[model samples]
Target: MKIKTTEQYNRIIQGATAILLTEGLAAFSTTKVAKHIQMAQSNIYVYFKNKDDLLVSVFRYHQKKYIQFLVDRIDLSLPPTDALRNLVSTLDEFHRTNKESLDVIWSIRQSTTLRQLIPKVSDDQIFIAIFQWLKDWQHQGTVRQLPLMYLTNLVFSAIIDYFQLIDSKEMSPNELAIEEIVPPLSALLFV
Candidate 1:
């Protein structure tokens, strides 16, 4: 598998996502991903060292894309409170639009083998940026003066919980609207 253009690399990652989503991690392999994208198995090896590397790469690729999406939509010039709101809203939009990718991510996190490869995927660049923003807000007295880890969990847990509720059919569409949830989340996290 000779080196090639970026598109080819993207195609491999896309195929890997599809395989994880449809086949579960137990069935994931370079061979399957290669077959999924109609490429040679060795080609996947050229880009990724092994199965775990490929899985981690796929997760990182999607995570970066998701973070970029939020960054592009969020207005950094706004006050911290408003910017946090924008971040939450952008996250909701990203989750809605990228459900399958999100599903693949969730699946990867749940897999014991893959989870070990990138145990702290949440600590990636996107989260570091958000954590820094939160710390700045705390310093400015805009957000509550809590441990950054607790604050990060508070906001992210709410978002994840809301998605789980919707996915489990525990919350009806109307009940889970961002407008209905963001206010409470804002009150809970912001000063």
Candidate 2:
């Protein structure tokens, strides 16, 4: 019941993520996650309060990792267009390289039923950093004055949606390259 190490905890999350990606959230359970990782179900219980906690944690974990990746790549001090390009490029790169993890989360967002089931968790500053940067740019009239949520979602969802199409084989892998994506995305976000 005592969660031992960070590595083990992350392994459990990654195992649950695999289940979510392959079997869908409707099929996810701590027992399946345990079996997927070849561990006792109680070990998952030790780390999480219950199924929802574990589920929320899985989403939160992946989001935090991705936000950190994006934030690290774009300098807040840069001109808005330059920063937006960096943001777009980083996101496209993430989609190309981190398909497996992105598949789990992007699918979750696509499902209204799954969205309502997962409990909301408070986010750390890392989660707020990207939004804050966008907000700062908006205040300076560099970014669009539209609702921040919509603005952010448009940029991220566009890239992920395309990648999801490719992952589902609904679209060809070569349908769109990063070069074609970034310029339009940067234009859409910055003035």
Candidate 3:
């Protein structure tokens, strides 16, 4: 099939993500993306220089979607505690609806090659905003004095672990209610 429309670019990224999540990076290739989307392999080169470029694009595509979701659903201006609760609820909502996105993120995170190829996310605008928000919380004595990155990583790491447990069948979302989960998460976030 001919990759004539701009929509093909989106298909390429989606196809690549599906491949990475299902078959792992070892099975990822621009040709595979093309084949997955029923386009010619050469057509993929029209948008990406190589597999690395395509992989990075795929990562950024999903990451931007996630960041946008947070920006839209999480009200950063709320009192810090309320903001954190909204953030947790937003994450749970994301986990329920976009589990494949979490899988794609985890797959890229575990890959050394992808990690090196993907640009740093710390400089992303929403990321900086979150970091600054953490700093403000610290200033207000809303959270501990630990380094911002440490606190951020701790929360994100725990979220990832929670998702992984669900993915691995060690935990079931229906078995535990969101109300059952919120208090402990709040305890962790607040001083």
Candidate 4:
């Protein structure tokens, strides 16, 4: 097993995700993952040190994929309200599409070992784009002139809680959509 470029490294991560999605994380053994990618388990060792490394890589890969999915689907040219709607809706759609992956991600506790394995994506980078959109609405007097970072945290906090509730089975997706998601977000951003 020889080390190679970033793309091959990513493919191993992707292979782990495919196994997790189909077989559930409990069954996502390194041998099974190697078979999924048509490689030897020894080959994976060349890239990821062990099972935890592979799991963390998979989580990071999925996070990037989720963000890119939203980036691709969202319309930046739209007005603030419309653009915000598109972004939120894209998140909702992502949760629906990758529910299992999200479940696995949430299951990973923020312990030192797991935290060390996971890569960091800055919250500021994600929110800066949102703030730029909100800036246009603020100028038009459609939104309040609040601190962009604060507002960004507020919105994502709500979204994360919603996902947690859904993941816990405390709220069904329909309840989340009608009772929690659409109404409250509308009030926060539009009203």
Candidate 5:
């Protein structure tokens, strides 16, 4: 087995994450990651048990970054409208930055087993901030009083559907159509 220096280990993991983000998890392999990092395949084995373990680590790393983005963007003290707008902007930025990985994430969601493997914003502490903001909005009568879980899942599903529509090349709807529909759909559930 080739033992990697600490820096080399981090480099390998970073390279592995790039592969997953660009090629999707299905195409991500330890050998490819090692090659990207200019390290031996055995060096990766020194840091990870196997490809599955490495993929999970990479998924967790990106998920945590996304959670941080949301946390930094949302101000619980702000009015509901402002908070929601900020949240949307944060998500738009995330989707824009990881467009390829986001598409891959959608593909992974098709596999129920894989969905379990991917970490979620809800599972992170930052999402608790969102929950608190929602509760505050409900108390102020600015938003609906539905259970947070119900609303969360509802919004999540709607957003996923919107992305799917965009991903479906054959459907060929204009971008304006999605932009027009998504806000109202989210607003209906939110308020």
Candidate 6:
């Protein structure tokens, strides 16, 4: 029962993603995905050789989609400060809208086996692009001369912490205002 069409493949991937998000990695199985999609369990084998392969595919699909979303929002032509603001806003919005997907990604990263199985998916290309932009800004004396990795971690870690606060309902909307948040973070990274 090899997937004969793009539609079927997408359907299986969607099913897999939903299962991973809801049930988590420990309970994820091709049979569960098949049941979720209302297909025979054996049918999933046509598209993926095993549960690990299917999970890897699901991770890759979401990773590419998320990166594209971030890339679309960021404009390299903008001033470094403005570009950083846009990037932060985009990231906040992405996390707000894709909480479940982000959770799945985080879980995958935490699991050494799954993390190694899909090494390329774990590569944060959007962060790399941002690092390059920051380096350019540093050369122009617009941003502070910190290590690129340190700056990248500082910015993204703050965003991640904000998401966690929101997830736990510990932060109110007023407290999470981007205006109040992004400026200080921008100042920390920029001159």
Top candidate by TM-score: 6
lDDT of 4 at 1: 46
Which regions of candidate 1 fall more than 4 Å away from where they truly are? Answer: 119-122
Q: What TM-score does candidate 3 reach?
A: 0.88
**CA lDDT, every prediction?**
0.80, 0.73, 0.78, 0.71, 0.66, 0.80
Q: Write the per-residue lDDT of candidate 4 for residues 79-145, one digit (tens) a residue.
A: 6656666777777788889876565565543445676566543342355677777667777877667
Off by over 4 Å in 4: 1-41, 50-52, 104-113, 116-126, 139-141, 176-180
- lDDT at 123, model 1: 70
List, residue by residue over 154-175, the lDDT tens digit for candidate 2.
7766766776677778878577
Clashing pairs in 5: none
Order of the predicted models by lDDT, top scorer first: 6, 1, 3, 2, 4, 5
Report how far off residue 42 is in candidate 5 (Å): 0.9
What are the C-alpha RMSDs, in order, of all predicted structures? 2.4, 3.5, 2.5, 4.3, 3.6, 2.0
User: lDDT per residue, candidate 6, 1-191, as tens digits?
Assistant: 35377898899989988898889888888878888999988777887888888888888887877888888787866877677778878888888787766876777777878888875431588877878888888899988998988888888888888878878889976776764677888879888
Per-residue lDDT tens digits for candidate 5, residues 1-191, read: 45458787668767976787678656778988888888789867788888777766665656666667766766657555555556665666677676655654455455566667676557657556667667777787877878977676665566566656666664444644434544675576566
Candidate 6 lDDT for residue 106: 77
Q: State how far residue 171 of model 2 sits from its true place (Å).
A: 3.6
In model 2, where do residues sit more than 4 Å from their true spots?
1-3, 110-145
What C-alpha lDDT, on a 0 to 100 scale, does residue 144 get in candidate 4?
68
Cα lDDT for residue 77, candidate 4:
76
Question: TM-score of every model?
Answer: 0.84, 0.75, 0.88, 0.67, 0.73, 0.89
Candidate 3 displacement at residue 155 in angstroms: 1.2
Error of 3 at 55 (Å): 0.7
